[model samples]
Target: MAWAWLVSRAAALGSGASGLAGRVWKIGADDPRRAVHGLKVGLALALVSVFYYTRPLYDGVGGAAMWAVMTVVVVFEYTVGGCVYKGFNRATATVSAGAVALGVHWIASKSGDRFEPVIRSGSLFLLAAAATFSRFIPTVKARFDYGVTIFILTYSLVAVSGYRVDALLAMAQQRISTVAIGISICLAVCVLICPVWAGQELHRLTARNMDKLAGAVEACVEGYFAEEE
Candidate 1:
């Protein structure tokens, strides 16, 4: 069963890499190393969450905290950064997110939970600072927009949802650990297999790009010679 799970995950990773490689080439004029960095960032974030949440965080507090933090992160990414509400007053999204946070805080307060606003407040501050810095820092923008967004928005949502339900509803630590381990193994396998497929796709795209470059160079040369003539 373990071996099967490992193999399955590895296959998924390889498939994902193959899909990713094609998409990367299609996006036009992006740095290959940067794209790979984004991929690694996503994978690292996944591993971090698994390691952090799976062990538990002050019982229900940990889970609640995770949700609270997640809510903020999602709201910012989908709305502010994505500019989903661009024409419609950007503050609308920020205000809405604030309201949601307040409501959740109120609920937690009513439950007699100790107010631990620090985690969320600090997170928001950092998120804002990071967003602000992104304008000035190209790599930060690249890392967050490409690396973090890809994993958190795409991969982690489904993965975390399952982890949360299993951890809470069934209280199954062993089961969750097994799953995490399986995923890790699968990721490793994918790394090995993906390079072959991804390399071929990269080569094809690079050849195409080179062809365009050649045509542009020829055009420039012809124009220069014609001017001389």
Candidate 2:
């Protein structure tokens, strides 16, 4: 009987733990903010899909159009400011790097067709190595870190991939455009829909914490005096 009772208790405890674990996932699931975010995600996907399928808007871009949608997926944040910061970083990196890639391609092209591939490869390796070292610098990493990395890759594709295909400049341009479209979509949703701002929330939380700490100290002092009396 004791063994049976112990088993039953263990099973009850297991069930209780499982229920607690399940409830953890549901935290804030019913909150209006969560609902708004869900709606935004759905709407963004649907809207991008429309653009994805439309030939005129995405013509010649082919599957590359998905990169635009991918950017939106990765950059979208619950807060408007968060989304904007990330989107801006990505867009800046994409466009700035693309421009540099075009210039690099033009330079590398002058080195004869056979030598072009070798030059492009060497340049890619050097750029990647340089970008790695650059990213460790606090000041540079703050803004241009992503830009440096993307610049290397974009420069590589435009210069090296040219041997395999035509219109290297056009490909570079399309990629930049796709990234811009993605950033635009994310920013629009984050701002126009139930807008939230992380900076404001952070400030509010700091104030609440200060207020609570003050109240707790006051309560403790009152209790201490009461005990002395």
Clash total of candidate 2: 0
Candidate 2, residues 1-229, lDDT tens digits: the string is 9999999999999999999977755765645687678789878877777668998876856667988888878778899877876777777767766676666677767878888778777777877788789999998788666656666666666666766767877777777778778788888888988888888879978999999999999999999999999
Screening candidate 2 with a backbone cut-off below 3 angstroms (N, C-alpha, C), the clashing residue pairs are: none
Report residue 186 deviation for candidate 2 (angstroms).
Answer: 0.5
Return the TM-score for candidate 1, rounded to 2 decimals.
0.26
TM-score of each: 0.26, 0.80
lDDT of 1 at 112: 46
List candidate 1 stretches off by more than 4 Å.
1-115, 118-136, 144-186, 192-200, 206-229
User: TM-score of model 2 relative to the true fold?
Assistant: 0.80
lDDT of 1 by residue, 3-118 (tens): 99999999999999999988868763464544553554355345445544655532433433343223323322211223222212222322333343444344433544244344
Which window of ten consecutive residues has the lowest lDDT sum in model 2? Answer: 23-32
lDDT scores in order: 0.43, 0.77
